[model samples]
Target: MSLTHDATLRELPTEHGVLRYHEAGDPGAPPLLLLHGSGPGVTGWRNFGANLPLFAEHFRCLVLEFPGFGVSDPTDQHPMVAALPAVGRFLDALGLEQVDVIGNSMGGVVSTRFALAQPDRIRRMVTVGGMGRAIFSPSPGEGLNLLMEFTEAPSRERLIEWLNSMVFDRALVTEQMIEERWAQATEPSTLAAARRMYSRAALEGMAKAASTSPEPPYWAMLHQVRARTLITWGRDDRVSPLDMALVPMRTIPDAELHVLPNCGHWAMIEQKSAWEAAVLAFLTRKD
Candidate 1:
C-alpha cells in the first residue's frame, strides 16, 4: 500500500512493544510526528488520513498508534506514561534525531509530557484540545462520566451519540463515521485494550482523572519550554473543556491559542481546513 494508504500497516519495535504506525509524506521532508487522541477507537490513520497529505507537502509525517492502542500491546508503563519512550524509540529506529509533533486530546497530554521531559527532542508542538495532565488545569469532561458510559456499552447509535456530543455541529456526525468508529471499537483487540486500559487506569487512580495534571515543577517546566507551541481547541469542547486551554495560554510563554467557533472536541475533524491551515502555519513559522 502507498504511504497515503493506511490499509498497508507497518510496525516498528520499541523497548516496550511494537508500535503499528502508518508512514506518509515526502520521505526526504523534515520529520513530523502526528499522535492520535485517546479515544477508544483511535488509530493514526483514522485520526490523520485527511490531513496527512497537507502536512506531507512539507514534512515526512509519521502517524503512530500509541502502544496498547492501535495494533500495539499494552506495555508495563501505564499507557499514558509510554508516549515519551514510544516516540523516543520511534525516532531512534527511523534515524530521526528530533522532530516536530502534533497531538490531540490524550495525544496532546503525551506530547506535553514528552516535551517537558526531553525538550531537545521536539522542535515544535501543536496541541488541539490537548488534555495536558497538569493537575492545575481542569479535569476531563469537567467531571462527567459520559465517555465511560458510552464505552461500557457501545453501539452504532452510542458511537454516533458520543460523536454528536464531541463535535459542536451534530450534522458533522455522519452515519458512516459512526459505523466506522464502532467497527474499530468492537474489534476484539481494540476492545480488549480498552478494557485493560480501564482496569489499569483504575489501579493507577487515573480512571476518573485521565486528564489529571502532571506533578510539581511540571507547571514550572511548561513555563520553561523553549520550543514554540501552538494550542488549538474547539470553544465548545466538553471532552477536555475549553477552560484548560487557558492553562497553556498563560503558562507557555511562546504559545498562542486559537479557538474555533461552532466546534467541539474534534477540531481537526470538525474544522479540518482551518485547523490544518493553523497547524501548518505554526509549524512552518521561523519566528
Candidate 2:
C-alpha cells in the first residue's frame, strides 16, 4: 500500500533473520541505502522522509528497519557491531556487491562497522550525526520508554516535554508527530524490547560497540576502508556531537566533513535540502 508517496514496503531475508525494508525510486539505478536513527517511532520512514524520494529520483534507495525497530523484530539482542555482517548478508540476498550508504545515528555506527569490516561492499559512505566516540549520550531506549509510559497512560504534557529534549526547537515537536510516536511506543512488545535495550548489560555493550568497533582509539580496522566518505553533523546535536566524531572525519583518508547550522541530532530531517544536496554531491563526485 502506498502511503505518503509510492515508496513500497518490502522484506528480504538475511543470515540472522528476515529484514523489513522500504524501496523507492528506480531499481536499476545505482543503489543507495538509507539507515534510520535510534528513536521511538524511528523507522527509516521517519528519519529519511524528506530525502528518500529525492534520492530515488537519481538513484535506487533502500531504507531498512533495524531488527529491533519498526516491523522488523522485537528484541535488543543484536548489538550494533553484531549487525555489521547482516548488512553484507543483506547485500548478498539482494545480489548487490556494493552500494552507497547513508545512515544516521545508530545506523551510522553500524554502517561504519560494515564499511570497516567489508570495505569492498561499500561504494561510498555518508553519516549524519554518527557516533564516532564514546560519550555520555543519554539512552534513546530510556527516552523511548518514558515516552511509552506517557502514551499508554495518557500523559500528553509529559510526552511533549520529552520531545523538547530531543529536538533543539520545541516548536518542531508537532502534536501530530508526538501522537504518531506515542502510538509506536505504546505498542506492547516495542516497550519491552526498548526496556531490554536500556538494561545495564546492553548499555555496556553499546559502549563497547562504540569504543572497540565503530570509532575510537580502536580504529585499527578503519584504515582499510577505501570508500570515499561524507560526515554531516547537526551542530547542535547533543547525541553524537560533531566535536566527538571529528577524529573519524579527519583521520579517514577519504573523508570530508560538513557541519550544518540551526540543526540538531536529526540533520537529515531538520535540514532536508542541505543534507540531500550534500549527500548527492558526495555520492556523485568524480574523484
Q: How accurate locally, in lDDT, is each candidate? A: 0.75, 0.71
**Where is model 2 more than 4 Å wrong at Cα?**
1-7, 13-16, 79-82, 134-159, 204-220
lDDT per residue for candidate 1 within 1-287, as digits (tens), equals 35455453678866677788877767798999889886656777777888876887899888888876646666655566676688778888989888999998878877888888788988898988855443444554531345555556766665666677777878876767777777778886666666554433453575335346555634456787767889999988877777777667888878999989888888888899999999999998777
Lowest lDDT 10-residue stretch of candidate 2: 134-143
The pairs that clash in candidate 1 are 133-212, 133-213, 133-214, 134-213, 134-214, 135-213
Model 2, 1-287: lDDT tens per residue? 24353447788866577887888877899999887776556677888766766787888888877776646755446534435666776778899999999988878878887887778888899988755653354444334445444434435576676666556666788979988987876577765555445445556666677667644433445566688888899887755555756567766788888988988778887877988888888898887
For candidate 2, report its TM-score.
0.83
Give lDDT: candidate 1, residue 253: 77
lDDT for model 2, on a 0 to 1 scale? 0.71
Evaluated at residue 279, the lDDT of candidate 1 is 91
TM-score to true structure, per model: 0.86, 0.83
